[model samples]
Target: MSALLVQPLVGGHTGAAPAHTGLAAGHPGFLSPSGVEIVFVLVGLVTLGAALVTVTTRQLVHAALWLVVALGGIAVEYLLLTAEFIAWVQVLIYVGSVVVLILFGLMLTRAPIGRSPDADSGNRWIALVVSLAAAATLVTVVVDAFRATWIDLEERTGPGQGSSEVTGTALFRHWVLPFEALSVLLLAALVGAIVLSKRNSDAGSGSGSRPGSTDSVPARRNKAGES
Candidate 1:
């Protein structure tokens, strides 16, 4: 009887050991305290640098590529938290689909393939100021709110808990409405893009047609003038 009771307690404690070890591993590397902090700081700096470059790059394509880097960094951060499903979703949605669509639009619109003075506009300073102010405000708010909070880095597993399974179940069940709304939003955006592309094509066709190109001049006058 004593053995049975102690067995349950021992099992419970043993089950928790791996999770504690995993959390202590600190994201596949940086087993030490300073190393973990260094990794986190480096990831943040890279993410910020990529974002700044994405915004400030004059080349549209370069900016889009920079955006990919920034987004990939975010995905990495998600992965660090052991949220593989969310990280892959971020990569698929943002880096794969959205960026491809943006590049397609740029190509279809015949946007200057090379550097253009018009690409670098006059409002850069204003945009920079606003961005910096917003970032500062957010950082201040977050720092103040969490300054004294202690984060428990414990990896607790429940019954049959996997990120992909849980995320899919949650998305399809409780969050179905938001998921459907997003689908609708994507559909609307696709339709708007199609309409704009068609309009541009029609405008280009109209401009290419000269006034006399389709005119039926009097046949007799044409023959006489040609002779």
Candidate 2:
């Protein structure tokens, strides 16, 4: 019994080795020749799918989650193309920070967890047309710009590439202002979200209270008295 089990296991391993070796040897030639183009197509498809879901999904949280996936795919593409710095930044900013903030905003705003017809806008057709036109314009511009350049796909960088260092230097030296501006923008967005939420809560509470209730009356009187 022992010999039978051991023989089968050894034979299975032996049979798998050649297949694995063949796949490994062939994969680089196949991938290296056309990997970048394949990845680009895949990235575009993923991004489009995610964007469609984001717009069409009735649940706000689902949209945000789809956005996370889209952003992550972009990061992966960056990494695949040897842009390590951009990839890490994408993960740090979009996946780590922005998505979390969006989720927080969704939770704080008391958005519906389930699908709702109210979430769908009536002007979806107009939006779709505009989006298609913009996409076509971008594609046209890109094709016009790079139509003559031949893409060499097999020349991928190894682990020793200086992408991170150069990116850091560029960010600090030339793009410092833009980086700072982004921080300011994020801060402003946070403040705006907080203010809007607070205003909504206040309005809700105020509406729930009787108009001439003593608490409101005294507050109004105090304001007038102070003025």
Candidate 1 deviant stretches above 4 angstroms: 1-37, 150-153, 158-162, 199-227
* TM-score between model 2 and native: 0.62
Question: Over all chains combined, what TM-score does candidate 1 have?
Answer: 0.66
- Tell me the lDDT of candidate 2: 0.74
TM per prediction: 0.66, 0.62
Winner by TM-score: 1
Question: After best superposition, candidate 1 residue 88: deviation in angstroms?
Answer: 0.4
When summed lDDT is taken over every stretch of 10 residues in candidate 1, the lowest stretch is: 22-31
| Pairs of residues at least 3 apart in sequence or in different chains that clash in candidate 1 | none
